[model samples]
Target: MTSRFMLIFAAISGFIFVALGAFGAHVLSKTMGAVEMGWIQTGLEYQAFHTLAILGLAVAMQRRISIWFY
Candidate 1:
């Protein structure tokens, strides 16, 4: 059901986040300095966290109480 979809989406998002992180480190690191790298890492971390939060919200949405709140 929706829970399954949410899990799948979360997994995909996690994979993308890892890929982006690796790209930033391996490809961009040479061009950017430490501060720029830190910024890129922070942005990726925030995106990854929000993607998980979306998954959590989807799970919560499946509950009766959550539906009521929404």
Candidate 2:
């Protein structure tokens, strides 16, 4: 997979991450219990973090960084 594709994928996932979080906060808050909402928020946090990490790596790759230790 190319770095461009990875970066684009990361960008799209980031948008999705925000949309889902907003949806959960505004829509699910009324229907879901506190515990469920908390879990959803936690999952979103984790997803955001991983996606950002991937984005960073993609940027690094695009810049031709020597990160791969192998």
**Model 2 ranges off by over 4 Å:** none
Highest TM-score: which candidate? Answer: 2
The residue-by-residue lDDT of candidate 1 on 1-70, one tens digit each, is 5767877888888888999999997899999999999899899989889888867867786663355544
Candidate 1 residue runs with Cα over 4 Å from true position: 1-9, 63-69
Instruction: Give the Å shift of residue 55 in candidate 1.
Output: 1.3
Predicted candidate 2 versus true structure: per-residue lDDT over 1-70, tens digit per residue = 7799989999999999999999998899999998999899999999899899989888888989889641
Question: lDDT at 41 for candidate 2?
Answer: 90
lDDT of model 2, residue 70: 15
Q: Score each candidate by Cα lDDT.
A: 0.82, 0.91
lDDT of 1 at 48: 88
